[model samples]
Target: MNEKLTKEEIMAALNERHSPEKQALLSEGRVAIAGLGGLGSNVAYALARIGVGHLHLIDFDVVDITNLNRQQYFMEHLGMYKTDALKSLLLKINPYLDIQTDCVKVTEENIVDLLGDEPIICEAFDRPEAKAMLVNGVLEHFPEKKLVSATGMAGYGSSNTIRTKRLMKNFYLCGDGVTEPEYGNGLMAPRVAICAAHEANMITRLILGEEEI
Candidate 1:
């Protein structure tokens, strides 16, 4: 039979991968991710693996067959609420993480309330309008918090174009910043994950007090 590792052992393994300073910062940082599809799901996965201390995930949708193409969810998770499913998966990765999830739709009126005092905001909505709403609302209401967003991650290849950009003070955007899902071109796993990685990496950098590019 396989032996189960204790929480201390699990944390020891994580600390080996990250420096004490980096791990300390990550373990103290709190990030809120809006939406739980391709971008949000993947970003959350990456952050959890790195031992981010707290995550506030908000998503009003449920897993569907279509999400299997690019999202982090599995076939078994189909039909479950995205927030609940993601929370389950993230906890499996790091049980010590402090995760708070909201299964309600994020709106202009409730964005700040849902996100609370988290200093990092991740924008992971798939629709253009929804993305704009979260970005605008957060920037307007919580200008001090850093906002990392994704755009134009559809299609495959051309991975180089997916980059992290400091759009303005306290605002960072990832992806090609142009491509959109259209005829013949659709969202795929590779590009979406790349964008998600960019967002996750930027979040890590900000948390570590590294200079933003």
Candidate 2:
């Protein structure tokens, strides 16, 4: 006799596709996104829909009028912490998502605490120095974990240039790496989102134990 799939069954089957292992690593995949701006916002939202269960959000900035251009923040979220605002939107998409917010500036001191047990980390810091600081600290602290950071997703040109490159073992870098607008650069929404998507995809693949995809 043939049996029908229930809601839980249907979702479980779909979840299995993300990671065949029990308690799907992807579904239980804990991740820490270190920025909550243009790239980070969309990345977090995309990961939530893709079945990422736990997320640790770290951001120290509030919504600004200038951020409305390409950032995910909307007019209604003005004056709100980016992490708080993103958490609200992410919860709306998937209430089951474990969204933990950290409205602190990541530094050498609090990085260890800010980052829980997430196996993968995404860097969305726009400022080069800030990004490097986090990257160095994480690498020094946890050499085994995977870290993906964006480099040069500025200016409005070809979307094709936005790509990902593996810098080393358990480390990947995404973005144009240059070709940004000269002084006072502007970033396009599509390009930023594309890069973030690649980073999220890499994180998913790593969690799945996929072979060097």
Candidate 3:
């Protein structure tokens, strides 16, 4: 039999694992994800499990069998919009999570409206052009917002090379930043998740008032 967990009960359990002060910071954290593929999916999962109070999920893609190799979705989610599928999965983990999803492609015109209020933004687009678009859009429009982006996680490369780099005062990049799927063994679960973890950890640190990147 499955039992429904009350919000208080969930918080109580989280409190036992995380210090009250840490949980409070996480609960007050609000972030936006610009792609619901590999990096976004993993980052969302991490944030939800750690008690992020609010999340804005943005993606115009859908779950596909090809995504299973590195994404958070399962076979059951194939063909569902990424935002919808990820939101459903996340709610199962933290029922009280404030998840606002948009099933539309992120463009410069809509970027501000979609992520205006989120202090932290994660860029998880697949293509270099798409990643540039989001990063440029955010940097140009929301200069003060913290942005975490990834590159070069593709392939069965050395995990040690996957690192978090503080590019700007508020921008961080994770991964080897050199490996490309077109030239390597291609995207694998372990490396992708490793980079995603770096992004998630950076976001959490930012939420907890860590200034040293």
> Whose lDDT is greatest here?
3
Q: Of the candidates numbered 2 and 3, which has the greater TM-score value? A: 3
Q: Which regions of candidate 1 deviate over 4 angstroms?
A: 1-3
Q: Which digits, one per residue and each the tens of the lDDT, describe model 1 over residues 1-213?
A: 356567788778878899777788889989998999999999999999999999999999999999999998999999999999999999888888999988999988887788767999999999999999989998889999999999988888598988888888899999998999987789999889999999999999998997468
Q: Could you give the candidate ranking by lDDT, starting with the highest?
A: 3, 1, 2
CA shift at 143, candidate 3, in angstroms?
Answer: 0.8
On a 0 to 100 scale, what is the lDDT of residue 60 in model 1? 93
Pitting candidate 1 against candidate 3, the one with the higher lDDT is 3
- Superior by TM-score: candidate 1 or candidate 3: 3
Window of ten residues with lowest summed lDDT in model 3: 179-188
Candidate 2, residue 199: lDDT:
83
Task: Give the candidate number with the greatest TM-score.
Answer: 3
Order of models, best TM-score first: 3, 1, 2
Give me the runs in candidate 3 sitting further than 4 Å from their true place: none
lDDT of each: 0.90, 0.81, 0.93
